[model samples]
Target: MDSGQEALTLLLLAPLFFICMVIEYRILKKRGYSDYSLKEVVCNFSLAGLHQAADLIATLLLMPFFLWLYQFRLLDFSLTPVTLIVLFILQDFFYYWFHRASHHIHWLWASHIAHHSSEKMNFTTAFRQSLTYPLSGMWLFWTPLMVIGFPPSAVVLIVALNLGFQFFVHTRIVKKLGWLENIFNTPSHHRVHHARNPEYIDKNFAGVLIIWDKWFGTFVEEKPSLVIDYGIPKQVNSWNPFVTTFHQWRTMLTLALSTKPTPFHIRLRYLFGSPKFADNAEKRGTTIK
Candidate 1:
């Protein structure tokens, strides 16, 4: 879809987003998960808006590349209804794996940590995207859709729609939808994804479907007794957009450069290991060596 069309769709979907948020908040209140303060919600969403603006600008600047890919044979030109549905599903499926990798891979985590840095779960949190994702190979994961004959327009539309669907999943309001929770990614499932608790960490990586998490062994049920602590263990407290995007990158680069003659394995681990691996090494009194 063109940028104008995408913007129109987002405008149309805005109401539905608010409706879902209200429904979710009511549910969370009923379930007693509504302990958060208004200030926390405002702060989180404000930072998220800044991040989204940066992302919007980046995506706009890169539209030419997307157009070129579409004009050539690299991306398909078909736009039948069936093709569109397939494209949407394919994009989401790839998103599931990409989201999972962002948690598992250290370098990717450096780019993704901004989203999880917020210690709150709300619809706005869903908008907390990484401005550095374009530089982090995130677009490469969706190339298969282009290769499989999805037009660039269709690809972009499906992506935006997929993201629109995910906005509802970020809230703490919706509890369970019976079997729906098992088949689809809901607020309940996403809460687990944002949790910092031991058992909740690195779980629930579905975008629109919960089946992906179930099939991949990353699914975890929400436990009321285990209070969900949102945000990374080492939080990035700054509201500055630039700081949020490059803070982890700076830290990782420092660690890598400071380790002289680093073995290939350690270098690879530094790039792909879990976020906590470095801290765990410190706790065990180990260094690169």
Candidate 2:
């Protein structure tokens, strides 16, 4: 499916999405654990709208760039049943690195924090994407697929599929999936990914599969003993979607262009290095929580 087809698919799934949200709310409320306020749900939808708008602007650059790269395709691979399967794996692999980098690298995190800004996790939270992602160089992560001869159409369609699979894993309503949790990116694994706890930080970066997290040292299984605290360490406690979207951008600029006779290298580090590096440049490792 192309972008248009993907849009149609998501549109068709809207009712199901609403139903899932309602069911999750009802169940969680029954269990006396659901804390989702009406205003919070509205915030989720608003942020999602903001993300979709920015995503459209992003495709203006991404679609053309991928197509241009496809012209120099090194090898022509037909989209057989086998090739699509291989491309899906490749796409997931690349998405892993992109997702991981977005956490470790400050510049990338500026665009990614929006998705994690919400303290609550639900299907709607998956829609809370950053407006800055396109400019944050996320599109460049997939360039390797184009250079390696994967058709642009297949590359984009596979990416959409990966994203579609990820939406359901955002909920706290579902816990472990028994055997499936061992292979796929289930809600349990993703809960760890979204966690603000020291042990859970930056773990489980897989887009569709959990195997990549296992291959990478980044994988951390959810600990039933410890309660998961969702949201980033630096919280954005605003209901305004624009405020949530631009919070990091403002923070980045302020940190990068500080009035303190900050050296060029330090400023550069704030713009490109680890999120914590900007403060106390020599500081290393996780600051004790």
Candidate 3:
């Protein structure tokens, strides 16, 4: 039942992740970038374990659904290079929308917030993943490929590959790759994505292709005028991985349930509104208007 890529990627990339982490650390240390801290790295590894474990469990649970959907596909897709290439492009397209939705929708943001909780940016920071990402509507975004006849196994493998490529882009050590920065998701684009600055928030949602952000009008160049401030607008302020994972959910639930005296529309807004709308309301001394 294993997509070969799962075992293969773990076998290969596990060591590669370690080596890359060491390389990035050395490179940053040589350049005198001291943002990488021990506690944050521990949390990153712990979160990565939880995140991948959830992905494995979700794959087993959802395999049947993907298989069932495959039967209904209008056109059968092979795992040939041409097909995989197309799906990779297609998957990146779907990823942009899913990533965008996670930013704007509170329910999804609860799961995604953990990834942006880290104050430091580095290759290891990419491992700061949400443990509940499967339930955050990530797999739902890839469903169209299954319905379009990509084999369940191929769909799963391609997703893993997309993520594998994404891990390398989470660093500050890399500069713009000249023309490559325009077409693909590079460290420059991804740094802007991870940045909390006003211009960077909710921009550059593409997983592999920077073109999606460009085409969708969500692209922003890493500004020379403004420094990239990494992490979420409202910092989590703790190294507890559990707190990092579920703090957003707690805030969302408290707001949603505290609307006993407020209107029904406000409760709905609390549930479905922007990531920090409830907190922002309290900050501004205004109820949902």
Q: TM-score: which candidate is best?
A: 3
| Cα RMSDs, all models | 3.2, 3.4, 1.9
Candidate 1 lDDT over residue span 1-289, tens digit each: 4654444566688888777767767776777875445665665555556555555666677777776665556544557787677777778889999998898787888888888887878776776677677677776777677666676566667777887888888876567889898789988999999988989989999999889889888889998788888888878777665666678888666555555666777656766777677556545545464
Q: Tens digits of per-residue lDDT for model 3 on 1-289?
A: 3634553675577888889889999998998889789899898888888888888888778878778887899897657889999988888888889899999898889999899888888988888988788877688998998888788777777788888899999998888899998899999899999998887888999899999889889999987678888898789998888899889888887777774577778877777888677778656655675
lDDT of each: 0.74, 0.81, 0.84
For residue 198, model 2's alpha carbon misses the true position, in angstroms, by 1.0
Largest lDDT belongs to which candidate?
Answer: 3
Per-candidate TM-scores read 0.83, 0.92, 0.94
**Clash count (model 3, backbone only):** 0
Clashing pairs in 2: none
lDDT of 2: 0.81
Instruction: Tell me how many clashing residue pairs each candidate has.
Output: 3, 0, 0
Winner on lDDT between 1 and 2 is 2
Worst 10 residues of 3 by lDDT: 1-10
